[model samples]
Target: MVELVVQKYGGTSLQTTGRMAEAADRIIKETKRGSQVIVVVSAMGRTTDDLTTLAGQVSSCPPAREMDLLLSTGEQVSCALMAMALKAGGVEAEALTGPQAGIITDFSYGDAVIKEVDPEPVRSRLKEGKVVIVSGFQGCPGGHEVATLGRGGSDTTAAVLAGALKADRCEIFTDVDGVYTADPGTITGARKYEQLDYESLSALAELGASVVHPRAAAAAEAWQIPLVVRSSLTEQTGTTILPGTWSSCSFPVIGVTSETGLSSFSLHEGADRREIGREWKNGLCPWKAVQHVKNRLYRIVVRNEEAPHTKSLLSRFGGRPDTGRALVHVIFRSKEGKQKAGSFMRDLPYTQDCFMVETQPHVWSMDVPERHRVNICQALHDRCMEKEAAPISAAH
Candidate 1:
């Protein structure tokens, strides 16, 4: 039986006609190696953002259903272009929308969850020696009505398809070569990890690492699928994420990351926390409660981009929200990790300016001014990651 390889090309890899041609050539080379290739593609560079801006211009608050309908087209355009590029290269290929490829999801509109995937059609196409080009991030529920997955959902789409099809491997081609110890854009000394465990990668994504989507990591982990994140522009080896166990005390700090575009809100003690939580869940907004003072206040953090919607929801419960905050986190593993994190925070250049500094078992998170996010991240990376003697690995 021929082996199967599932690959996803990010927006940066398909930003232009030349890039798409290059990507097509890359895929053709893989086919020449005798493996069936299934390609998933995101929108062209900034196309999703451009569409969102256009939608906002038409309406202050567009309906979620219509937004999904609008946003899904971006991926469709990419898929069609990629297929055209492949055909022009003398390769057999067919473009498929999410629904056409049999991706079924819930009716959550802007942030739908994939309920199931039917890969029979895709498999049939592959048997015919045709490369299957799939539009990532959007799916149909009940065989009708377009619904889009949340941000970076194309990653999820690729992972799901790989798992369902029982592919040999899943490759995510993006701008960067691989997952770095810290965001390479922020830290000059940040090094790329040759391999990573699913847990660590998922944590990085959830905390603000933009290399791979968190949901995609979770799906890959759940399916026990092997994933390679690599650069499409070069022949870099890239990073591999899979199941593994490690035990080493020499490595503690793995990476440092920050999330900007944040807003903090304080809910009074008498406010219904349950109701507030429910509202966020129902709206599919990402958030976290950072601190809860004894019968005084509850400090909640949410994405600044979602602040307007969050505020509108909070207003119904008489809650006032404040924006313009950011969070920085240091990821480490050690018996005394919390203490080490606290000491590190105290030594920072602007400890006094921090609104809050808290330590979990393996993470140290601090709330700071939005303007200081990048600086804080760089500082943490310099003091922690760059100076560390050993690479990040779990204690045995």
Candidate 2:
């Protein structure tokens, strides 16, 4: 039996014809190594963003269904172009949209959840000795409806396909080599993790690490699929996410992640909590937080892109919005991690306006001003690394 491999290439890896050709070469090499390859491609660099911008120019608020219909086209372009590149490399390859590949989802338009996937469509192609390239991020419920999974949806598509096909492994090729202790762009001394458990990666991804999507990490965990994160431009080894919790140290803190462009809201007295819940669910909005603080007051954090829709939902219930906020999370390996992080945050004199919350026993979340996001991440990351290195220094 031939081993099956599921590979996902992000926008940066397929930004140009040269890059697309590189991806095609990578896929062809795998076929030569005696493996059946299934390729998942994202829209080329900035295509999705460009499409969104174009929609905004036409309408202040585009209809969700139409937006999905428009966004789904980006992935189709990528899939077709990738197939052409592979063919030019003298390999038999075919392109299929998400629906054509048998990905079924609900009618949520913008952020649809995959209901089921039938791998037979892809398997048939594999049996024909053709490399299959599937458009990621868009699936259909039924006739004439196209729904896009939210940002980073390609990662989820690859993981789900790997599980459905029982592939040997799922490799996610991105611009970065692997998952790091912090965003390397922000923290210059950040360390790259060689291996991470599902729980750790899931926590990091959910908290705002762009390395992997939270749903993808969860699906891989559920299916017990081996997931690897590698660099598309280099041959260096990347991070492997596997089952079981493994730690490199007892310090507990493992990574730091930060997200900007946030709009926060506070639901005060007389707000209809139930109605707000329905709107959130039905609207498919990404709420970063919905925590109850005190005295019937609830704090909600959402991305800036979805703020307009979220604000409209909030206003119906006496809620107020505050933009230019940022969220940073410190992920840890143990419960004790929270206490340590909390103590450190309390003592740090960075910003008095910052508020800390114990989102999870192993996750410390901070709501800070956008201006201080990078500084806070850098400080916390450096402190964690200091603790990590202390033990070795003492032994020496």
Candidate 3:
């Protein structure tokens, strides 16, 4: 069987002129191994922010639809640079926009979900022995309007490609060697995982592991696609999100990931509480849910980066933060211990009595306790179990 691989290069991996060339060279080297290649590239650096700034200047409150149009340029610039890099490496490569690549999505503007991918052109180019470079994270649905898949979206594009093309593996090239136990910059003794299950990977994504998108991981997990997170700066192997990598490892949380600029909502009002609790929601839209309370007092979590806007958003509706952090660990717990350990979750909407989200043996979870001066993590250390781990291989 012929081998075809789908690889995604994040913004940091394509930050500088040298990095762009370096990334292209990596893709070209893979192609030279007699395998077909499909490459996904993000905007070189803060191009998305630059575009956002321009969009805001044009419209005080930029519409989501138009913002998609502005942000699509990020991926285009990346694709062009990647194509140029491939050409410099003696590879016959062509960069195609999301539409040109046939990535069909729903009508969502800023965060569209991929619906279908016609891989005919992609496969044709590969059959003709050419490398195909695609602009990730943006696609069109039912018309000519450009749509974006939101931040950290390019990773989803690559995983979707792997599922559609049935590639050998979806290799994600980023700055880190692989998924680590923590940010490494923050926590001590943060180890990297050789392999992670899809469920665990999703947990990490929610916890701020930038290596993969939860939506993309969902797609790959649904199709059993092998997804690898490796460093573009080094030859070392990264973490692989696989099916049964943790049949033995009993770690309840595979990694300690954090997110900053978070705002937690604390609702307190009898009138508001009596109206079926129409407020508190968390995470992305799909992950959103309604919160029910006997009283109006409620809490919601939001990114600190958006706090200024969030405060304004809530001020309009009588919202206030009980307290928040510039950054948070966003911890994880296993289903096995959900009821025993996180009984507080029963009071919220997303959380139910013993009703937990999907999880793996190696998974991550988080929650906020009633008491602010609490650390739920002291028990996480007890989650580590003795298993037959292979001798730790030096990253290479």
Candidate 4:
């Protein structure tokens, strides 16, 4: 039996016709190596952002269903272009939308969850020696209209397909080489991690690492799928994420991650907590319920990008929004214990301005001004992540 591989290319990897051609060549090269390849692609360049801008121009608060319908077109366009590029390169290829490829998701409009995937069509295409190109980030359920997964959702799409198909590997091609000690774009001396466990990567993603999607990391972990994140434009080995355990001695601080464009919403103590909780649970806006509450106020943190929609949803229940907040998290092995971690946090350059601090077994997070995020990240990296730490062996 031929080996099977599921590969996902990010928007930057397929940004231009020339880049698409390069990706096609990569697929064909894999096929020549005796592996059947299934390709999943995200919208090219800033297509999704452009679509959102278009929607915003039409209405400040567009209906979720209609926005999904409009946004889903971006991936479809990428899929079609990729197929064309593959065909032009003399490879038999066919492009498929998520639904056409048998991805069944929940009816959550703008943030659909993939419940199941029927791999028959993809298998048939493979048997016919045709490379299958799939549109990522969009899906449809039995009776509902088109729906989209949230931002960075293409990663989830690829991982889910890989699991359902039981592929040998899932390769995520991005502009960056791999997961690093910090956002390389912001931190000058950030080092690339050659390998990481699913849990570590998931934490980074949740905290604000753009390289890997949190949901995608979770799905891959649940399915026990092997994941390789590499640069599409370079020959770097990238990083591998799989199930394992590591010693604290070898890996102290995995990375420093910060999220800007964050906003906090608070409801008065007397407000209906039950209704607020229900609305938050059922609402489309992405938010994290903060454990710390002060002065009888219930607080939730949301991405600044989604602040408008989140505020709109919260307004129905009388919640107030506070925009322009930021969070910085320093991630490390939990074995270090909270006391040691708390000490590390205290040692950072500036702590007087930090309004809130949360320390977990493996992560230490603090609330700070959006403007100070980059400086904080750099400071944390210089203080913690830059030092040489013992390497921990991963338990297979």
Query: Model 4, residue 240: what's the lDDT?
Result: 88
* Backbone Cα, N, C clashes tallied per candidate: 4, 0, 16, 3
Off by over 4 Å in 4: 246-249, 264-300, 304-322, 359-361, 389-396
What TM-score goes with each of the models? 0.89, 0.87, 0.78, 0.87
Order of candidates by TM-score, top first?
1, 2, 4, 3
Which RMSD does model 1 reach against the true structure? 3.3
Candidate 4 C-alpha error for residue 108, in Å: 0.5
* lDDT values for all models: 0.83, 0.85, 0.68, 0.82
Q: Model 1 compared with the native: what TM-score?
A: 0.89
* Tens digit of per-residue lDDT, candidate 3, span 208-295: 7676788988988988998898899999988887886433445444544555444455444543543323333332222111233444
TM-score-better candidate, 1 vs 2: 1
Q: How would you encode candidate 1's per-residue C-alpha lDDT over 277-367 as one tens digit per residue?
A: 5665675666654554654436667777777776776665556767778888888766555566657776888776575534244788888
Highest lDDT: give the candidate number: 2
Candidate 2 residue-wise lDDT at 8: 99
lDDT of 2 by residue, 1-396 (tens): 788999999999999989998988899999999999999999999999999999999999999999999999999999999999899889999999999999999988899999999889999999999999999998888886779999999999999999999999999999998988888877868877776778888888888889999999999999999999999999887888877763544557878898888988877776666666666667577687665555343777888988888888678666788889999888877667767777777776775667764355577788788998988988888776665642121110
lDDT of 4 at 272: 63
Superposed by TM-score, candidate 1 places the C-alpha of residue 114 at a distance from the truth, in angstroms, of 0.5
Candidate 4 per-residue lDDT, tens place, 339-382, comes to 45457677776676564544345777877778788988888777
